[model samples]
Target: MSRIAKRFAETRASGRAALIPYVTAGDPAPDVTVPLLHDLVAAGADLLELGVPFSDPMADGPVIQLACERSLAHGTRLRDVLAMVREFRQTDSETPVVLMGYLNPVERMGAEVFASAAAEAGVDGVLMVDLPPEESDDLTGLLERAGIDPIFLVAPTTADARLSHVAAAARGFIYYVSLKGVTGAQSLDPAALGARLGAIRAITELPLGVGFGIRDAATAGAVARVADAVVVGSAIVRLAEQYPDAPERFRAAAAELAREMRTAMDAARADAAPAAV
Candidate 1:
């Protein structure tokens, strides 16, 4: 089984939800990105999404926009991000790593080239915000060939027909955007997200991950009640910005938050099943 699928199955068997966290590669520098990833795993992150800075991050809010800008200014490229992933995988071969970025860079690198490079770097998935499901065949085919998942996002405003399309294209899991706006937006309502998640669940047996506007343990636990995975991005990335030079500090900040969320989700899951294995 894929890393994400196996992890989710273990989480279910243990009566818990998966804790997925995000950080921008080369934000402060690649030096910080690699070690920070190790810290996240040590702190109980089931999966990690490494953001590749882009010129135009339409799906990201100001916080993430600034993060991307910093990463770009530090000479962060898709190649460098992939290199970082390769380095991280020498030790962390179990946790799934997802490349979160825009299509411009991937297109510039070419579909087949990027997919092969990502697989060599030990990346398990890619999540491009602007890439629509209708236009994902080439990348999907390449990633599937390499055993890499291509995750897609669905918003609260998504049509049911499109949900199935996305579900079919997406591999690891479908990221269910809790709000209508970009990442880090404040308006998050679980009701509509629950409805959309239910729709997605009806179509695909793949795990459904929810993100955006999730700030802490309580929120993560609340979402864990329904979703198979809880993705927390902006808040963790923001902490990395504060400790750019010290990778351990950056990792500590993110890992600490992830630990809290993971613990909460585990606690919440116990109400549904037995103890962890």
Candidate 2:
């Protein structure tokens, strides 16, 4: 199994949801990316989603859009993000790094070329927000050939028929956008989310990761009850944007948030466990 599959399997066996944290690769600066990644893992992140800065990130909110702008201002191209992954893999080989971005950069470099380079850079998966599964055959086939999984997003409004399509195309895990608006634009209703997750689980047994609108430990714990994993993006990006000049502060803040989410998720799982008879 891939590192991502292994991590999810291990977390499931332990009866706890995995904590996945997201951060832009070159948000504050390119040099700080690797250290920040390591810090997140140390703070209990089971998987890492590194945003590849794009010129136009339409699906993102103001916080992440600003993050992309900062990274782009520093000339943080797709290749640079891949290099960061390579450097990160030099010490940590177990953590799965999924490149999350739009398709413009990947297409600019050519799908096949990007696939080879990303595989060599120790990237385990890719999540192109704009790449629908229907139009993703060429790139998805190439990525799978290179041993990299293709992750897809499922929104709250996705139909059951469409869920099957995404489930078949998806490999690592399906990321369910928990809200109707953009990232960080709203709040999550755990009861409603649980019902949606129930429908999704009926379609596919693949791990489901609930993201967007998850801002604090309390919410993370609530989502963990029904999700195989919890994904946090804009919250971490806000820290980078908040402490633009202080990389240490950015790293500390990101790690702290991740640790809090991790603790809450685990505690929720414990509370749900059945008592010994």
The best candidate in terms of lDDT: 2
Off by over 4 Å in 1: 244-247, 274-277
Worst 10 residues of 1 by lDDT: 268-277
Give the per-residue lDDT of model 2 (tens digit) for 1-277. Answer: 9988998999999999999999998989999999999999999999999999988899999999999999999999999999999999999999999999999999999999999999999999999999999999999999999999999999988988898999999999999999988887778899999999999998998999989999999999999988999999998999988899999999999999999999999998898777411
Count of backbone clashes for each model? 0, 0
For model 2, the run of ten residues with the poorest summed lDDT? 268-277
Clashes counted in candidate 1 amount to: 0
Which model scores highest in TM-score?
2
RMSD of each: 2.2, 1.3
lDDT of each: 0.86, 0.94
Question: Which lDDT value does model 2 have at 47?
Answer: 94
